[model samples]
Target: MTESPASKPVPAREIISWAFYDFANSGYTTVVLTTIYSAYFVGVVAAELDSGEPGSATLLWTLAIAAANFIVLISGPIVGAIADFRASKKAFLFASSVACVAATALLSTVGPENVAFAVLLLTISSVAFTSGENLIAAFLPEIASNKNMGRISGYGWSLGYFGGLLTLGCCLAYINYATGRGLDATHYVPVCLLITAIVFAVTATPTFVWLRERATPQKLPPRKGYISAGFGHVLTTLSHARQLPDLFRFLLCIVLFQAGVATVVVTAAIFAQDVMQFDSQQLIILIMVVNLTAAVGAFLFGFAQDRFGSVNSLVAALLIWILAIAVALQASSEADIWITGNMIGLAMGATQAGGRALIGQLTPVSHNGEIFGLWGLANRTAAILGPISYGVINRLSGGDHQLSLISTLVFFVVGLLVLLTVKEQRGHAAAARAN
Candidate 1:
């Protein structure tokens, strides 16, 4: 039997390169999904279609996000399987990155009148973005040891927040300059999208250059095509999931908790803009601060995860999320939101970093890509359900952002309860045996 790549002496450079992908991709989420374009779409593009109705625009945005994530949910496992069979993780990653960058850049062409165009481009870019995210994550177990997985994953996530911060900062500077000269969202927003694309393209290049394809290619079975094989792999793996009970159980927790995280990722700016009357400048600043706190949280919790345990670290983070949501629900001023949002930021980093590390710990090295694809599936499932749920609630409440926001609390609480059942040591032992 061939040795798994997980046992290879992975260099620090490969790990850093792997982390840089996180950094590279963060701009897309920060500028396009989280900070700039989501609010712009809500306040401008879809608003034009809905005659400035916040609920309708919000719903449209969430629907577009849900649609994109739905595609990811269906395609992720298959793509991962194909990459595993063909040893084409880098190829798939590169292709997805190109698609995402090009689609995001073309977003510069979307005007207020082009609501459908906006949604179409957003869906394409979002699909590409998420596919790439899953592919990159599939590299984690290959590059890190079980003991240090949390710290390594934390490094990636912390760097990712910095990447987001830098992207948002540059965009904010441009926004300040453009608005200072009397440019409106029409002129300035396009430039921000273009900037995000350029940054994504440039920053992500190092990942391709430095990251090695460690998986050995598997020979195709007689008469089996890659696609069919891919589907077969997914079904077979899922059928055997009971053997890795803790991993599957944790995936359920991811589905539940990640719903809240996804909702916040897509809706934070919209919530602030609509509920707190935050201007674009204020929104960027708020998110930048959040990014800073998130980075710090990831860094600190990385060590904490190693010292304590993945489950414990994650539980602490979820509790913080519950508190953040509680504060957000009752927030009556910018200061209140600032406080709660930063708390969320802290928890966001810890939860994401800790969760990925735990998955890395629990996953068999040989099935790295396929398993992470399921991770993506879990996350994409949350993305689909969470934002749509929030959108529906907001619309039903007649654009009540506060009420809609409260739904996130339920996911966190339930997720926390589910997480407690994940036997981390048992999961790790199972993966080690599989190896």
Candidate 2:
């Protein structure tokens, strides 16, 4: 098979800078969505809204997350199409990055009395974060050869885990020290969020300085329909995807399992809080440990992706995820929960890094921006379904988390079955020819 243009290598420094974006974004993901602020939102902000029902805050938090995902799902494609056509990925990335950092920092001011503000800021921050994600991923095709895609993607994910681990470590230490000195965690949680914003800004700077857009700008069609051109890009891809069977098949699998992944990620902290009775300090510690394992998993699976093939690596990771969820179902104690958390880390890193590398390998270099936009769309759809399903189930079951955990297994199992039919090498060849 002939190499796609994306398989051409850029500067090593550019690759490092690109990877650092993952570090930056993970600060928000680990702190706000996964560990501290999510729990803070449910336990502190949304709790005051309904004193009699603990589940109310959890439901609201999930719904807010679902709303943000829906917004991203609707907009990711058009924004991606525009970036591709304009050859302005960095410009859009910078805009989204600023919005996320600013919103995260501003979130420091919101407390229990300001539920609506919390929702508004979260929706904005999540959307901004997602936008940045799509833009950065669009850079992958420009930076690494298909042969190294797995390693590069894996490295980025590993660094993200380190970012998460480092951020969580600091938060855990401060919360421990603060609570020991008689300061309430509620007072300190906002400060932790501010630190996350700073970390995000600082770590993400390298990408702005070093990475360059490689795609030549494509002018929109003359006049009239130009405004809606972005919408047409993804639609055209969807209509013609069967011609690139592997890419299409992989995306379908992503939508299936990634929804499960999204649910597991967003809920892990709150699940610990609501079910396992973990305080902020304990939750941070748990997440830190998970990040440590996740980093290792990303590193190992990335290599495995290159050697064993991305599909095999991803399938193995999904099986681990299935087992992790099963463990979570039986988690009735801290040790049991710890087991679940560690397993999640292992599977999380492997699956995500593998999936990303697989997509990079399968896509034509010219279509990176638009194709990954579809990737983001699939991700956001999962984002919508996973959290909403969890929230609805929680509401229906009176917050029975075990049942919610059980629901995620269907995604992994089904995704794996679908993925079995995909031929990665054939897919890459098809993409190269299409381009």
Candidate 3:
């Protein structure tokens, strides 16, 4: 009898450490990027800007996001190639994570009137966060065996959601306590940002200590023009993409679908403040609920992927996203916010975890960094469009957030159609062979 791939076990400690990086970083995604800092930027920092400017705040925010995406688009492939060549994946991960932590901690000092400071800090932090995410993703192949990759990826995302959930809960409690005593809850934003940095730094420590890189570190050629090297890598990856049809298809799906996901993250705080009239405490609660629910969804979907298939799980997650967006568009009250938030939680975890698993199934270990770099570019560059769409629609419609949210559905539907054409099982088989 042949031993099944599913019967093999990965090192438990390494997997845990790798997943803990997600746990640590999720706090930044939750507190800074998604809820508190975004709201602070738009409502406080940007609000203080000169008056009579047409959509100036939204435009600045959009540009910041675009700049971050542009950096990722240019640098992701080079970083991936370097990771592969040097086999210094862990070192890369540590450096990027520390950058993120430092950037986030620096955000603590940006005051309400400090729009320039806020923009600079947030942009740097966003770049670091996304870059670190790409590095962390390269670790999956090291920790999980092929058969259990989907479940393991899901577990990591689930744990991340839980971490976000807990942090948001703490933030909410502090906000409520501050507000009740007639103190300023807004001041706590920086404090929370600092805590997020510390937590990420601490949680990510284990990954650096434990996870072993499979490839040997290579000596990079004497520093040529960095910009030229970056652009060359990007061009090569883009041209090479056509040679891998399945990977191209997967990249396309992720590019479109993830745009919607990224838009939701960037816009949720704005929606709550503008539409639902939520203060900081209420907004924190909403975020906490979503993260909690997403954690559960991640675990469940991970199990489902193992039992059924990653493609199937991903398809179902897209459908859920469509429904969640529709519900969010129609939400008029706090109760509606709760309902939609819960639905988002379920869909968000499945979308991220399942997507990673599917990508893992399609990529060769030797090319993991390069392919995942393309994946990062696709994910982040595609994100640039959604925010632009939302900002444009919001301005045109006089802040009609419902109409703005409808734009997201197009991404999900298109991605779903493209994904439906994919032969997932065959793709996975090919990926295994390439590995």
Candidate 4:
């Protein structure tokens, strides 16, 4: 028996499930990485140690983040390959989700006396969350039609921001109601993380149930040889990408631009607390404002992409980021920081959703997971550099945050230059042939 085609497109329930994972996972980004947990690490965990120590608690946090990025860089391609071969995207998602939940829940045990244990748990959770994101992201093109890909991607991002906003709000409420007069706000960080993990696990169930994996064209290799096969495929894909000038240019632009994006995200909370001296309430407000603006930006840019093309929309977003970061460097007051945060919110959603949609438009279907795995590698590897550069510059310049921010312009400028050389029409043609 053959399946019947419906007049109206089947509602993308599976796609929504895939997207909600972003929603579920974003709580971690907002509550743990960006605002609450970071503050806890620097303020509470690091406070126990001596000031101005070279290998102090702050250094350990930075090293842990770098380590997680490196692990993702190495493992992304192999995981993508395994998912593609086994048609096991959902399975991988489930496993990673569980890992994230377990690690995050464990974070609640971290305290002033157990700083090392806290960082260790956070590192594991961070790695798991990121790895899970890779699997969920790879499922996008399978569920979204080309015409609606940008819009769907926008919705996913919007939902993620909303999720972040919700979690941030809850944290703020908890702080207001529960904390005593003299208690450090940092003590509540682990509780927020634990809540985030529970929410992630609960919300992630629909995705596994609703999403169906598409069959992969590539044959499954023997279990003993799969690792070698995956690596071999990675090398082959890299060679092919080198030969395709447009693809090569796209990847280069992605690396540079995403580095800038990562820098903004990783540093936003730190910048607020350390440089602007924002309190927890103010930091939560700032995060919500940015997240709200990003939701708006994603919708606007997705519409613009449908009309003007992804490349044009992306270039426009990059220009906005350049201006935002420039303003961020000069921002001193809370008002100025809030304005900068809004601008970042505007650019963040567009840059990421548009870039991913562009890749979906450009890549050959047969190589979707492989190509996206490479894209993930570039993103993760770039993450390593962005934070390290920010930390080094911030530490070196007598803790001058502005100088560290100025470094981001290099990424945006270089990314724009490389993007101009790419041929979108050729990429579309390649995609058509693969289909």
Candidate 5:
């Protein structure tokens, strides 16, 4: 069932359904990872245990996120190989999606007294979210034409931002209601987490129902066990790095720059809270603007990547990230913070869409899950390194966020310099030959 370049045309219905999964999962990413619950984890949920110690809550939260990413990094390629061999991407997607939704909903029960429970649920949900992302992204090559891969990836991302906007809107509505009722707004966090889970469940229905499995199950290679085959393929791919230099090189760059990008995302609310003294509502508003601008960026840059090529498009976006963090480090006013956030949104949207599309372009549709597993490895590696580094820096600096912001600039610069070695067409050809 692995597709050549001439695979049958993908239905538009299926494509839209596939994109809706992005719309669904993004609520968790924005609401939990970047905005509301992240702040709650630090300022409220973990507040009791840490006894108001500097950086303790942030460190705990970072370690939980780091642990989740570490799990994904180790396991993604193996699961990806099995899914590819079995042509059971939908099955993997369903399991991970349910785990994520359940964990997200269960987060509602965690309060100040049970920081351990909150961290546990966060770790589970983060792993499920990332696992689902790897599988869903594997489908890109199945659905898109080479010419429109960037645009289609952008479509998914732009739509994802709108989902974030809608989820934030829901939180805003509830916060307003709570305030009018003379209630503490922060206590309403568990309820908002519940709302996020429901949104994801409702929106993701179309993906499970409409998206077709394009890759048929293949026989196990002679004498190979599932786990062995999985690890073997990954090792073989690595050994042949010279043959797939662009893909390998792209992964190297991803591990570096994505570390910087994810650090900014996970720390943005904290930075705003600590430096700008933003309340929950203000932080939510700021994230909403970032989501709005991110949608615009995805729409604009989706095609820009197609026209200019993924490597070039990604390089430009990384420059923006470098500039954004530099500005954030220097900013002293609310206006300056706003400017930095918007810049981050633009760069994040473009780089993510371009990076996914670039992988689609380089990989064969047949071995997609395995290759995208590599993508997952890079992504989660960044997830682990970025948050841990930021957490450590915050601890060392006694929560001095400006110093942490300044440190991320180096990741971007190094990643950009390394990215110059890739040759896109060669990677595409090599992947095709391997499949």
Candidate 6:
């Protein structure tokens, strides 16, 4: 007899391999989107465009991010559904990673005059990165039981922040070396992009080699193509929204909170540079501090998640986010920004780890991909909404990024309110019944 998913043994090797994917991919977000390339695009690339609007670079960058996330928003659920039906989550993950790595490496060719080129590459890589992210997350229910999902998920996230730190550290070292040699960003940023891609490729290799695909292929309906079948399955899952009330409710909450999270992820570097007058090295150091704290937060919160419940942990995290935003709004000196960034980092780590764990707990193994696809759908939707909203606010506020940041508070506050409505026990019970 085939083993039930819940009873299936997850080897330690597989868990490590799974976690390594997070380790590998964190570099992309850290180096490209959050630290090096984003600032390069705004300060150097888009500046060459000679756009009269002070916020044009920020707007363009957010548009690129939003555009990529929009693609993921449309395709992520379908991809997950297909991955579940075909038992090809790993294959899909590999494809997405390859695309991301390749596109990221090619970003080295872009120059100050290549605004459109830079945006195109950024969009492609972002799509691949987000898609792979969703695919990897689908592995959670298969590799972990509901009881310890928080701890295990926390392992991946904590490791991911460390990975980001490592990547940022390497890039910072290179930037310092290049700066010492009197090289401009146009000369050095490309190399940093290449470094991020190489690290991503090297670190992610273990996941492809060591991680096992545990999903069993489901029978397809006669005459239906995989794409159509995938859509049908997604629709069928959506049709049962009422049955999984808590899960759906939690997803709604994710949409709101993730908006705040997404805004911070894509725009924090921009804010640091534009508002705080932080140079490249100082900006990197600030982010590295955030990464270290974020790693610690994820590691500790994982245990807290298991002990205290996901909802409670998440509530605490969101409350911290609100507080961080308050601090950020009034931030004046480097000291104030440091405190705010650390607060944001701690809350970010706990929020991300807690949310993913809760979803894993609430999700049935049988539809891990499809359900997490919906989770991805929520995330991508937030990604699209959040950064774009921030950009719009920046534009409207005459390039005042500080004013734009207040919008993040709304997402967290409202999301927390909605989160209070989701009964955690009911969510777990619903998943058990579905299984």
Write one digit per residue (lDDT tens) for candidate 5, span 1-435: 666434578778999999999999999999999999888888888876457568888888889999999999999998898898899989999999999999999999887888788889999999999999999999889889779999999999999999988888998889878878887745688789988999999999999999988888888999999899989878865686777788888998999999998888788898898788999889999999999989988888999988988888888898898898888889999999999999999998998888899988887666789889999999999888888888988878887878877668888999899888888888878877876
Q: Give the local distance difference test score of model 5.
A: 0.88
Candidate 4 TM-score, C-alpha based: 0.93
lDDT of 1 by residue, 162-258 (tens): 9999899999999999999999989999999999999999999889999988888998778999999999999988986778999999999999999
Local distance difference test, per candidate? 0.92, 0.86, 0.79, 0.76, 0.88, 0.90
Tell me the spans in candidate 4 whose CA falls farther than 4 Å from its real position.
Answer: 1-10, 48-50, 54-59, 180-183, 216-218, 221-224
lDDT of 4 by residue, 1-435 (tens): 101112235456766777787788888888877887776777677665537643244445666777787898999888777666666667877888898889988887878788778778878888898888777777667766567777877878888888787777877777776576554565566667777877778777777788776744467556746678778778877877644557667878988988888777766777788788988878888888899999899878888887788888888998888888888878867788877888889999898788887776776666667777777888887778777777677666756667878778788888988888888778777666655
- Model 2: runs farther than 4 Å from truth? 1-8, 224-226
lDDT at 215 for candidate 4?
A: 42
TM-score list, all predictions: 0.98, 0.97, 0.92, 0.93, 0.97, 0.98
Error (Å) of candidate 4 at residue 185 is 2.1
Error of 5 at 248 (Å): 0.3
Candidate 6 residue pairs in clash (backbone atoms < 3 Å): none
Error of 3 at 297 (Å): 1.0
RMSDs, each prediction?
1.3, 1.9, 3.3, 2.8, 1.4, 1.3
Candidate 3 deviant stretches above 4 angstroms? 1-9, 49-55, 218-243, 433-435
List the candidates ranked by lDDT, beginning with the highest. Answer: 1, 6, 5, 2, 3, 4
lDDT: which is higher, 4 or 6?
6
lDDT of 4 at 188: 65
